[model samples]
Target: MATRISSSFRGLILLSFFAYLCLCAHEAEETTETQHHHQISHTIPVISLIPSNACTSSAKGSERKASLEVIHKYGPCFQSKNYDEKVPNHLEILLQDQARVNSIHSRLSKEYSDNNKSRDSQVATLPATSGLPIGTGNYIVTVGLGTPKNDLKLIFDTGSDLTWTQCEPCARSCYSQVDPIFDPSKSTSYSKISCNSSECSQLISATGKPTTLLLYLRLRIRYKYGDGSFTIGDFSKDRLTITTEDVLDNFLFGCGQDNEGLFKGAAGLLGLGRNQISIVKQAAQKYGQFFSYCLPSTSDSKGHLTFGNGGVSSTVKFTALQTLSQSQSFYGLDLIGLSVGGTQLSIPKSAFSQEPSSIPARLSKVCLAFAGNRNETSIGIIGNTQQRELEVVYDVAGERIGFGKGGCR
Candidate 1:
């Protein structure tokens, strides 16, 4: 009896030893993954805390305000316009986004150096597809561009300072777009800015390229993006109608006669950068320099871009904007840390960097949306995934940015 009991006890002990080994091995695998994410960029993690019935969660205490319908290029709105979504190569997208980041850094650096030397200089995505979106895409909004109102769909960009579109009589070459190239001549409100005007000289700081006289009166300007795409055209102003109640006149914009870039069938860009040239600066008096936008977390849901503070909810959280550079053209946020599965990541604060930089990871497989910039000294962009399903509000007058959840509903 004693011998039998000893044999059973020894067998039980052996079993426990194996189980312990298995647990250690499993933990190592997990450590490897966590380390992978940690090592990739030394950043942290952000998990979606979206509650069920997100619409109720999103709208509780928040007013449903509308101004411009912000749509994904691959969403139903663009498809209804007969514009096909651009096929995305994820690796390529990352590379190009990095290029764009590089361009922005270069522009900001030059602007900063010029300021220290004499002051003032110049500067510088898609997620929709097959249920597989890029971290973000060129979000578009429609607005009227002249008398008789040529309603144009523009890629509303907070990173860019000049609102521009392809114009009629493509003086050089223009990319094909869904809307008819804006016929500036047909618009009674359209007027070309002269080379000698103060506004024309402002283009020097805006585009980071000096204005040149194509003729004694014509101010021809060229603006290049980090993706190696560019626009060379006339700098002009026209009446910009955002909504029936929110019309802005004398809105300076680019009439791209020689526009080259993959805009994915949108008419052009709407600049909302942090300078006097941005629409935010141009329309500050009417709207109080306040605007907010929500990118839908899913394709079926809707997102919006409104120009007032009427929709702010009580639950919204605000983060102070950090000046990562001298130009201050883009929205800056200090992403001090990240967390995973409710645990804060143990890493340096220097890791967090740009637009909504992540996607919800899948089960049993982790693919981080963060990428390392060219160098650690590079400026960071507000990560797109970081803003997923949240309302991003810009209070330029307040000099602080805010976010509210449940916005996609």
Candidate 2:
């Protein structure tokens, strides 16, 4: 019995020693962790992590990752019961600390994206369209051409072919509102067709008025900003200077003209529609064969226009209607098929008008008219009433139509 008691006492003593050793080991570990935290705090203060502005929702994820990355690379300055909840108090502070290197990287990223998008747009012309009238026929816009006499922009149009702006032969002083008339005297390449020139004759407005030229394209733009309108002062023979991804050359344009109430910047107009030998056509001949324009939508007030190659994106299907004979140029289309999203739509042949009066004199001129808005005497006035109901797109790459407009608001 005495021997057993002694053995039990010995066993108790050993167990106590073991427990004491474990306690010492745990204390040592705690001290080591504390020392590591202190070292990190000295290296990078927590105050350096906050941004000047409050973090936006987008930055939250990035901020979290960045904070963790810093900790991983250099150890953390603070301790948390749970590692997942560890976060810095500020993000801008971190950015400021790394400002010099960070800014350079950010700028390079932006530039790369811009360059990529421009190149893609230029190469996508097979599926895109020029916002300008590249072919022949008729097209119209509510243009406010600035008058050289009064500098008043005027707006009236027919989807025809020709470009001329109001110029200085007016009964009144022509320079009151317009910028100094385009002085062809300035450009080495300026050439004038006589007032009786055939090109000028073709410019006869549907209203039977004579077309006039004031300033032709050079390499300058004269702006009159009082009425949300402006003008390009440079007109040239089949050449235009525009900022683009491609090296554009030899385009033509009407430097400026006075139209009535069409734009918001100046007293001039750019003859961009599919009129004869206008600025847009000249540029296409010299650059890429196509361009595109996306008008402002209610959801997105600003859109884009691309010439040449366009971007690749998922396409909504569409039904192509038979293009009117006049649907050849300026603004024309060959209606072949139509689809919405992925569904095809059928259009009745009766939807087309066969009456000579209902049809435009020109075979390629497609008339956009309302069912009840047809004027017995009017030739090709596309009724504005129906513009809101349909989205029109033209496939000119095919055999039926060469020009197109619509699918924009």
Using TM-score as the measure, the top candidate is 1
Reference-based TM-score, model 2:
0.34
Cα deviation of 325 in candidate 1 (Å)? 2.8
lDDT of 1 by residue, 283-374 (tens): 88888889887765533345677787786766667765544444566565534334555454565434445445354545654545455555
Residue 379 of model 1, lDDT score: 49
Error of 1 at 339 (Å): 5.0
After TM-score superposition, the amount by which residue 55's alpha carbon in candidate 1 deviates from its true location, in angstroms, is: 16
lDDT of 2 by residue, 31-83 (tens): 11111000000122223323222211111112221110001101122122322
lDDT score, candidate 1: 0.57
TM-score of each: 0.72, 0.34
Residue ranges of candidate 2 with Cα displaced over 4 Å:
1-160, 163-181, 194-239, 244-250, 254-267, 271-276, 286-288, 298-300, 316-323, 326-371, 374-409
User: Which portions of model 1 show Cα errors greater than 4 Å?
Assistant: 1-66, 80-85, 113-137, 205-215, 339-362, 365-369
